[model samples]
Target: MTDVTLMDFHADWCGPCKTQDPIIEEIEEDYDEVTFEYVDVDEEPDIANEYQVRSIPTIIVKNEEGVVERFVGVTQRDTIEDALSQAGN
Candidate 1:
């Protein structure tokens, strides 16, 4: 099986990031096969820069092959779930 990871990039001060957090949390509960990582841009600038994340609430779904999908801003739960399903497959 492939190793799938969901990276959430955001800062504590970002409002949109707050909005996106719960959706990610829900996805975390549903997708046990996917690894979830939360990166605080303020604390982990290098990681954010490595991912080229220019905005808050950036959701990146990637597998061992590499990044499969990237969503900027507030993303819908279904959209993220779909991306995970595809990437996992």
Candidate 2:
């Protein structure tokens, strides 16, 4: 099975992203199998552009092979878990 990696695409200026930060932290503590990475759009413009992340809070879940299975805004716990399960498979 491939390992799961969750990339959070966010800008420091985004209010909604700030709110989601705590929730992500909680997920990190709760799920040991999921790896979480935060990417600042201002610092990592290339990554943001590559993912076409126009929104403030975008979540991208990838397998070890680097294939994205989930891409959307403001990820919830269940959504992230589902992605992790798929990646685990």
**Which candidate has the top score in lDDT?**
1
In the range 54-80, model 1's lDDT, one tens digit per residue, is 988899999989999999999999899
lDDT of candidates 1 onward, in order: 0.93, 0.81
Q: Model 1: C-alpha RMSD to truth?
A: 0.7
Q: Give, for candidate 1, the lowest lDDT window spanning 10 residues.
A: 25-34
The CA lDDT at 57 in model 2 is: 88
Task: Please give the TM-score that candidate 1 achieves against the real structure.
Answer: 0.96
Q: Pick the TM-score winner.
A: 1
C-alpha TM-score for every candidate: 0.96, 0.84
lDDT per residue, candidate 2, 1-89, as tens digits?
66888888888898888877887888889878778889999999999899888887888888867756655666677777787788778
TM-score of 2: 0.84
Runs of candidate 2 with Cα error greater than 4 angstroms are none
Count of clashing residue pairs in every prediction: 0, 0
What global local distance difference test value does model 1 have?
Answer: 0.93
* Clash pairs, model 1 backbone: none
